[model samples]
Target: TQLLEQSPQFLSIQEGENLTVYCNSSSVFSSLQWYRQEPGEGPVLLVTVVTGGEVKKLKRLTFQFGDARKDSSLHITAAQPGDTGLYLCAGRDTGGFKTIFGAGTRLFVKA
Candidate 1:
């Protein structure tokens, strides 16, 4: 079975701090996606990196895909209060349309 495991289930930091979150799995994924969800809202796609060793950036956020396609990472720089939210990583299985989600990392950024 394909499964994704995420680390550092929670994070709290002051404004301008930097942090990193990891997602790992033993199973290979065809594509991996990262999302950020705010209070009372569904997760919105932050980025999708399909190729191995791929890196994508959005403003202060950076995302990287493992060379083995079984892991991924998210790095946030100069985090602001508005950056506080739930960060999730999901993998899409080629065998089916189903996608497996990680436990999620909840971030709290203080002003």
Candidate 2:
């Protein structure tokens, strides 16, 4: 079994501050996905990276996949209060249908 570990399990910062969260794993994955979940809601898909070294941006958020497809990172620029939530990273196994998820990073942005 593979595991995904995320760093800085919790974070609190003033609004407009920039932050980066990391997700890492020892196993290589075919694809990786990032999601965000607010209180009382399921996680919402933010982005999916299929190719190694691929980078995607959504507004003030940026997502990147490691060159070896074994890790990923999420960077938020000028993070706002609305960005407060739980950030999750999931990776699909290269030769199986199983997907492993990280422990998750909880972010709180104070206004």
Candidate 3:
């Protein structure tokens, strides 16, 4: 079984719609990162949340880390066609050196 299985694994929406993606885990990480990726290209870092209970916003994107540092969520406002891509959440365990990723969320924003 996968350690991280994000919710609503696949999403298809219309342009200008808003959606939220979630990452839940029983493990706690020292830091967590969010990324957006396209076909054949590397993931593009959106933001990293380290401090528990921290919230960060970039343009229409909003990211949050759980107060226990065991979970995270991403919310996108006014979704655009450009937002169509794969969204991923990854983090390293409190003691582990390697980073593990939650099953990616595939978003399809239609015009």
Highest lDDT model number: 2
RMSD to the true structure for each prediction, in A, is 0.9, 0.7, 1.4
**lDDT (Cα atoms) of all candidates against the true structure:** 0.94, 0.96, 0.91
C-alpha positional error of residue 42 in candidate 3 after TM-score superposition, expressed in Å? 1.5
Write the residue-wise lDDT of candidate 2 on 1-82 in tens digits: 8999998899999999999999999999999999999999999999999999999999999999999999999999999999
Cα deviation at 98, candidate 1, in Å, is 1.0
- For each candidate in turn, the TM-score is 0.96, 0.98, 0.95
lDDT, candidate 3, equals 0.91
Please list the residue runs of candidate 3 whose C-alpha ends up more than 4 Å from where it truly belongs after superposition: none
Ranked by TM-score, top first: 2, 1, 3
> Across residues 44-105, which tens digit of lDDT does each residue of candidate 1 receive?
99999899999999999999999999999999999999999999999998775899899999
For candidate 3, the 10 contiguous residues with the lowest summed lDDT are: 1-10
Off by over 4 Å in 2: none
Q: For model 3, what is the alpha-carbon lDDT of residue 60?
A: 99
